[model samples]
Target: MRGNILQKSFIALQWKTSFTSQYLVAPTQVIKSMNVGNIRFIADAKNSGSKLEATVFQDDHHRDGRWWNISTEWKVACSFVVAVTSFFLNARYERIQVQKEIKLNRIQSQIKDLYGPLYGNRLVSDTSYRAVMKSHKGLKKYLSEARRKKDAEMIHCWRSYVWNVLYPLDKAAVDLILNNAHLIAQGEFPKEFEQLLMHAARMEFVMESWKNDDGALESAKRFDDDDYLEVSNASGLIFRTQILTHVKQKYDTLRDEQKQILLDISSDKQADDILAKIYQKVTHQDL
Candidate 1:
């Protein structure tokens, strides 16, 4: 009886030792290859005699592995969310900046138009005139020579300048003619004065049409094309010429007394002087 008990104790010790060795030394592939029955048998054997908790160790390892995988997945998710948020924020900022720049440019343009000529004349004191002359010295010299020679191209160039810059009809100038329409109709103004006013009004109409129909105001501000300048000048001249011719034809159909009134108005020295000063202001030149 004593021998059998000792032998049983020895066998139990060996079994425990074998189970511990297998659990500790088994590779993942070897553990995976074990059948459910084998695993259960090992677990039962380990539970029966061993004080070391093999099942507890395995449970702790599984929980730790699961926690590690969850941590990794959460970190990746957080990074992606932060990246998307930052991208949207940056895009929104850029859009706001662009809008601010556009508004600033518009305000600057309005300020320039209101005060530019008052600060410096384009033909005389402005830096832009010097810059243009410096950059196109040859062209300037050639144009001067051509003007002296009465070249047709030079004449056309000067005419373009006159229409585009000298005789440009702004709101103030347009208002002047529109407000004096009663005087024109009553023959209280000279035929020459009436024709000039008609020309200015028609040119204003043409400019407004171009601005509204062709969306040319923004392009005109750029001043990058000689062709556009030429077209604008020619268009202004043609419109004014047509209107003036019509007015003259109508005047010819008027009675002798009306014609005499127009002649008397034209011959008024004081009125002519006032008209000349107004023309000088509009054209920025000595008439």
Candidate 2:
């Protein structure tokens, strides 16, 4: 550095000496030309490669260059950290989204296909049974004394109302419960729901006993005690306790979960979009 600076200084001195000797007659013009030439020489020397060294010695661009390297490195590290963090966060976010969607789908199946129909069946069963029981002498008395004595009123009510109305409703409820056991929250389901199926099964045999007897009068017209089918396991279900209350509670809970999951999914989408923008700006890449 010292050698280079000294060489330029010597050249400047030669120019000054030449200006003094050669331009003595025309000092002003020669001095102007010499000054310009000397300045150009110094500039050329500085441009030759001394600029970087000079800048370093003067504590200028060297620090800037170092600081730029540091800045770029910092940005790279920041990008790396952000990339790693985003990778894990996005993975976990997708996992949670998958879980929420799975649960939401399950609830949808329950409400739309299973419990929804079962609940409607419950309403029909409860309303029809209560209405019929209200008008008649009640199911127990009608089946026991009235049915045994072959009472006209009981037989007419069975043929007209019970056989036509309640039978179909009960069959639907049983079929729903039987088919959709997978959606049950308690896995095995409440005994009441089981018992309802048992009741329906027995009632099916009782109603269809006419067909079993080849259309005979006693078997076709009446529910004979002799033709009672003993359903296995004695599973019992009460529509009110098992279906009405349980299904409502389950349906409401699932609906709430579904609503919350929808909100979470919306928020997660927003978060993912924001993260994608940040990642693009940081790493200069698309999601």
Candidate 3:
């Protein structure tokens, strides 16, 4: 009987130790968890020396059931977050691409309809005019030495250039501005551009009057060789020729602002984050 008692005590101690070890390891997660009813059932017959009967786990089922529900809720929430992020990110990407296309189109229009023609015509006119000045000194000595055949020939060449070449090119530039004034960079027309139109108009009247007078040097005498040399390089014509330098600056600046060229572009983890960046990059800030 004493050996039997010793064996029962050892067995009870071992069972308690095992339960404690499982509780310590993962009390809430264990399938063999003990609840208050089982603890009481163990206590009621602690020393009665009866067979211990118990369920492996609690009957409540709330704790583990709630955990499974929480896990499933978290899964659904994460899926929703991913969906929302994808939707907005795609929208932001399209918006940025559209904005880029709009800007590129406007730059194209400015280059094609306005600055391109203006710059090209000015380049040709200025190049030819400068070549004449460099080659023949541009009707300067011709005025004093008009009695000589070579000087007369030089004056005739210069005069023909002023009428045929210079006037036509200036008129073409003026017409371009008139047709596309809406495309100017500023709110109002530039004074330089306006002066070009005025110069073209003034020279047109002079040419018409000279031709009407049968070309007896009528416009030349009245306008005077000295005035011709001075006013030919007037403020309007200055702006016209200076455009060879100015247009290039504006053109290249716009080109560098292009969507594909600027460095330091990056991707974002979220939609709104990158949307703000693109707005600042494409619209507000300089590229």
lDDT of 2 at 13: 52
**Residue pairs whose backbone atoms clash in candidate 2:** 192-237, 194-236, 195-235, 195-236, 195-237, 196-236, 196-237
**Top-lDDT structure, candidate number:** 2
lDDT of 1 by residue, 102-206 (tens): 644543432233222212222232243344446446334645555455455554454454446545433333454455444243445445444555656656654
Give a tens-digit lDDT track for model 3, residues 10-46: 4665577467553332122212334533322232232
Please report, in order, the local distance difference test score of every candidate based on alpha carbons: 0.45, 0.61, 0.59
List the candidates' TM-scores in order: 0.25, 0.65, 0.58
Report the candidate with higher TM-score, 1 versus 2. 2
Error of 3 at 201 (Å): 1.0
Clash pairs, model 1 backbone: none
Runs in model 1 lying further than 4 Å from the true structure: 1-15, 18-56, 59-61, 111-114, 122-287
Regions of model 3 farther than 4 Å from truth: 1-64, 136-155, 212-237, 259-287
Best by TM-score: 2
